[model samples]
Target: MALWIEAESVERRSNATEDDLQAIIRAVYRQVLGNAHVLDSQRLTNVESQFRNGDITVRNFVRAVAQSDLYRSRCFETSSPYRFIELNFKHLLGRAPQDQAEIAEHVQIYHQYGYEAEINSYIDSDEYIRSFGEHLVPSARGNRTQSGIKNVSFNRSFTLMRGFAANDVGKSAKLISDIGGNLPTKIVAPSGASGVYSNTGKRFRVAVSQVSYGPRVTQSVTTFEVGYSQLSQKIQNIQKTGGKILRVTEVA
Candidate 1:
């Protein structure tokens, strides 16, 4: 007779704290804007004075800031906060908010929780606020800044354990028959061993070494090689082997 039992349980983790979200937002702003303090004091004062002198209005100041290097660097061209309030809301929520009311509500929530104060401090810092008023409007085209480029190429390799089988045959013929027939079966590596080269112009190759196998059997060295045309193929090879691909190591 045999007995068996089964059970299952589920657990949920806490969501990210508001502070964590705000920190990420601040980092993104910094990466885009560069150091805001670099803006010249004289330039900011001139812009401010222009507004006071009725040479340019407050709306012009906003427009000037919006088109300046500070804004272009901090704001994404398509999905930045300046383009849409919803995008800013999404940065905070980890997803886009549904409507203007939702955007306003979350912004308020962040403010109530003191997250906005931290955000305001970053925005008001010499690095951010001053950058806004430093430069004048260009005549024809928008200023472009360099971003999101990678230089080095790297490769990833992987191996998988497909499956295994074992047979034990004692001296007794009847015992062997009871277990299974003959034992000299072929052993195959787990399906799919794969590798990848991200960034063009680099080739990737995979070499598989048989780690260890057989009962009480020493003196074993097994090796094989397979090249992949695409990353998906590499993943497939590893999956077939029931083995994991190793981290990509760069080779130039």
Candidate 2:
């Protein structure tokens, strides 16, 4: 699971609806690609349809965005190594570079393996595999910054700590384009003593938390578990809802 501020905000939502899927697609356009116009493109529409139909996961949707021609022109083409690498961290991993060295490390990859390889590195990293598996989306949390906040895993409410919110013009714009904040889904490991997991399926079992937002003035966001197997559905829920997940376990 991926989130902007805290890790606890992410979860595996089995009850995600068509509206939630649409909202999620919008979230991807604004947050991952940073171009609202891309939402109108047939490519994105196709990807959305595939994801909604379960032909793809949020992780696959994310991969499509990064590998899309739109992302190449907007993010990679003609950009400095530093700028490109930094954007990759934001778009692919959903966070900024941990430090100059991290940037340098990625830069070296870009130089040696070409742009595509650089992109794959982030998606293929252990962090991606462990936190998100292949069915979740990535969101920004100051995972690498010296000013990063301590990660709050799945259990209790998580507040977006400082340093994770991007300060740059484009970065801030992307956050604004979606819903002016992060989503309520996350991919995290199980919590406490191994929690529960079906002895079937080849993927990880994640604990999911449901999220909702209200009144920007109040900065009101709330999350809870309506039940173990399902969550509250707002129906075509155009509201912002996503977070970091915790206590995930690999099943069968």
Quantify all predictions' global Cα lDDT against the true fold: 0.29, 0.50
For every candidate structure, what is the RMSD over all alpha carbons to the true structure, in angstroms? 26.4, 20.0
Cα lDDT of model 1 by residue, 183-243, tens digit: 1222223334422112223334433323344785443333223222243344334535644
The best candidate by TM-score is: 2
Can you write out model 2's per-residue Cα lDDT over 25-51, one digit (the tens) per residue?
766665566433553544577877788
TM-score computed on alpha carbons, candidate 2: 0.52
Which numbered prediction scores highest in lDDT against the true structure? Answer: 2
For each candidate in turn, the TM-score is 0.20, 0.52
Instruction: Give the C-alpha lDDT of model 1.
Output: 0.29
Stretches of candidate 2 above 4 Å error?
A: 1-12, 35-39, 143-252
Candidate 1: list runs displaced more than 4 Å: 1-38, 41-46, 77-252
